[model samples]
Target chain A: MSVDVKTVKRVAHLARIAVSEDDAERMTGELNAILGFVEQLNEVDVSGVEPMTSVTPMEMKKRIDVVTDGNKAADIVANAPATDENFFLVPKVVE
Target chain B: MSDLTRLTISQARAKLHGKEITATEITEAYLSAIDRANPALNAYVAVTGDKARDMAKISDARLVKGEGGALEGIPLGIKDLFGTEGVHTQACSHVLDGFKPRYESTVTSNLWADGAVMLGKLNMDEFAMGSSNETSYYGPVINPWRRSRLDTVVMPTTHQGDGGFVSAGGTKTQRSLDNAQLVPGGSSGGSATAVSAFLCAGATATDTGGSIRQPAAFTGTVGIKPTYGRCSRWGIVAFASSLDQAGPIARDVRDAAILLKSMASVDPKDTTSVDRPVPDYEAAIGKPIKGMKVGIPKEYRVEGMPEEIEALWQKGIAWLKDAGAEIVDISLPHTKYALPAYYIVAPAEASSNLARYDGVRYGLRVPGKDIVEMYEKTRAAGFGREVKRRIMIGTYVLSAGYYDAYYLQAQKVRNLIKRDFENVFAAGVDVILTPATPSAAFGIADEDMAADPVKMYLNDIFTVTVNMAGLPGIAVPAGLDPKGLPLGLQLIGRPFEEETLFQTAAVIEQAAGTFQPEKWW
Candidate 1:
């Protein structure tokens, strides 16, 4: 299925990346081309095939709920563009 | 001293141990080379000269005590995707504006623990999204190798008669790349270009779909994508989590083995890491491949195959034959579907992995009225066009209604493709061989690639299947095309069977001999 300009806008919104009118329009054709190319996968019969859950076959290791590593509040916000007292600052949302 | 930059990693290792040369001297050689060439090559985004010397000093002290680690003082380039603690680790994207990671990636830490010196971070495609390094924000890396114009003046022109000259039957002018720049290939294009031009002894590279192998093939270097989970992924900027893997790009196959030995390890941080003993891959070189079964995948012989690449494949077969390996024709029936399925699976994972890049945590931020608008504006200003396109495609595929028809179906096709390699290997095919790329390097900002993204994706045609199968693959420079650009032959190995790939690749390197671009840059 080809994505229209509206779908492109919706996808961009879902992805949380703002697209201008020009970018959305341009992406419509670009995304359609890629989607069209990948549409060839429909020809393959995937009967009885399970979607790959992991690249390698391994059981997920369960760990006891414990603070294995911690006490690095400063390092977590070390690269944020705006931070104060090791807390990331962002645009206010709640009233 | 002038020739110090030409020495391979193995060679430099010998000199360091023998005390014939100091680590500082070699480090200086590379630093100066990078200083001279990086302006034209654009391979290295950050050259950590002082850090290289400091690390070299530590290596020299260890060598004085005869306690040097595996890589002992050898300088290497780090792909920007790797997080170097307190160093520039932007992945060549504006999204990570001025970001220096607080922690180090496990792979880079492994190299450092082995006494390898850091030459600095290399450039890459923004978030490893594109095939050509053209997608990088810093700028596309210019390949050192260029087409020789001796026999390439193909266009016919007619000139009018002048006072002293007669009308020409058909005039021809020499065509050279005086202004044309060839791409080094990507997303590890910087790593490949640096290694090929000797900007670093070897470089850390990652492969999601052909990032490592494609660039290595273009630059006449050697690169190996170890089996998935072979190298720990912790601290690396995530791309497609399942498909992304860490490897090395080096000047030759043996150097690739040497670098990989130091780069791979199982880490507690990365759960997917394989808990297998890391072998001395350098020891695997020069090993006999007598009676080994090499599979020639019939599907790899794609239509419009270049004559030179085919000839190179034939040459590789003959060399392996002479080396006592039996070439067996095999079929990977789901091969053609691998690329299309990859377009779905990679982007879907990329979309999820890249979600962590919101302005709330780190990097670039654009002010907005609300939190959501802030994220939207920040990401819009930060991510490149190709990245946005992939994220959008990924969101579309994983969105409410289209998930099963697109994402799930692609994953199933992925399983079928993986099974194709499994069935072939189960039939006693020790390793599969194919051309590394359909053609050699193309021009930077090539007009055709600008018009269609699919054309750029086709560059990874042969290399992506290896990643899909989570199998080990190596690209070894085998021959040069008539244009004088390098072409490579790929060897696909079974899971965790990197030793055989190194051994077989060593055989090819021996037969073909390694090539070097003439000093032009």
Candidate 2:
């Protein structure tokens, strides 16, 4: 389960993190080391064990699907690096 | 009394209630200490001096009216991970540079509601990722403690008095005064530093796989990570939603209990925050542990564990036994797999949790020709190396082909680990005891640890199993290593049974006297 540079590049792309060739090369080795450590999990027999999503087993509490709070667009956008009026300004998506 | 800044939370509360000192005076004392020590320690990234004074003034007024809350007039530090309205809440990372939330975290709001004053936002491992606090963008938090130098033994000198050159007693015992800057452990490193250095009465910290307890152990403070659903996570930045639980790092077990009582509450906003009543955790202190069963897990005896840590564990066992508790040897077979499984589950959740920070909304935004390119540029520049590494590891494991092999497999292993704790508890084991960490705090920016991420992740080895089981764990400073640095012993309790942990930890604290470093800063 060794990670190669090509796989590292793909993961970076999938993660939306721009990685240069040099960074990818270094990441290949680092990711491989992590995978090597995690590879030990293969030794344990987990055939009957259910994957635990939450440690405490409780039914997810349901709520009526209604917005209790909103409409304060200014407050939501207060920390935006670049917000125009009520909308967050970003590079044009359609263009 | 002693220095006003050195008062524990209980001590400060008594003084404030007795009108021996005003909240304003104590807050000023802490401010002066922070001014003097923060430059060397870098523990606090933002000091709310004016805000602290304003809050202290309000507390003083409340005391005058004979109507103050539980933690009235006590100043404390807030970890950067918790959101403080209009203050620095970046989690010590560049991604959230200049990002201040309009809302305060539930934990801090609870503290403020109890009349606790905020000293400032403390530094931490960036996004609570690293073990040594070096991952913090602000810089590494220099531990206030350094290894004590060996005592200088001097020979007796001859003195001539009336009795013609008789040998006199002149043995000089000089204490070691070495001043190398040791690390204050991580994730909650800033909180531990502030509390250990007496910069704050206590601090609010979150533990996702040992972040709270490890740092507490390293800095010789008391840290308790309450049960997973004990504290409301609303407004606290999400890391791993299932594992992240907020607790406190304080100067002692009672202070930790006091802070935890104020910090834990059920919130409608966080449905996972259980509706159980928050108990008087401080009251649990001094309760006898006679006839209680303390389980010593066999699997925690990993190879290469330092002799001091093992000795400390033995000392803790003896102390608990002397306090009238029965020691039982238990086997948590899944302990070894906890770390590997934790790495997967934590990162898998982190990658999802951190996806909110793109170029569009809040935080650092680097523009590019297109929205897609803009996201890549912003994230590339925004995140630190360790953060980026985790994101990539997360992305790779969660990718289309590898999901079952890595993410799903890790989740299954996590279940086994949890089941191990349940089995032990079901067998009449009241609480579990183990070392808090593999070793004492290492030097800041150790080259070997920084080079390899896996080596750094190993720091949480002792404390991660508690998180995997969603149980409460406390680190009590038990003894000093041969180097004179503090070493802590951990006690893991059953789910939602933080009271048991508090009682047991108090016994350990009573047996092993509190550790305080000489004033070097």
**Most TM-score-accurate candidate:** 2
DockQ of 2: 0.84
Looking at model 1 chain A, report the run of 10 residues with the lowest lDDT sum: A55-64
For each candidate, report its DockQ versus the true two-chain complex. Answer: 0.80, 0.84
DockQ class, candidate 1:
medium
Error of 1 at B249 (Å): 0.3
The C-alpha TM-scores of every prediction are 0.95, 0.97
lDDT of 1 by residue, B1-521 (tens): 45898999889999999999888999999999999999999999998999999999999999999999989989999999999999999999999899998899999999999999999999999999887899999999988888865332333355542322332544344434344679999999999999999899999999999999999999999999999989999999999999999999999988999989888997778888988899989898999999999999999999998899999999999999999999999999999999999999999999999998898788899999899999999999999999998888888999999999999999999999999999998999999999999999999889999999999999999999998889999999999988779999999999999999999999999999998887788
Candidate 1 structure lDDT: 0.92
Please report, as a value between 0 and 1, the fraction of native contacts recovered by candidate 1: 0.87
Scoring model 1 with DockQ, what do you get? 0.80
| lDDT of candidate 1 at residue B9, scale 0 to 100 | 89
Q: Which stretches of candidate 1 lie over 4 Å from their true place?
A: B151-179
Docking class of 2: high
Candidate 2's residue-wise lDDT over B360-437, tens digit each? Answer: 778889988788889999999999999999999898899999999999999999999999999999999999999999
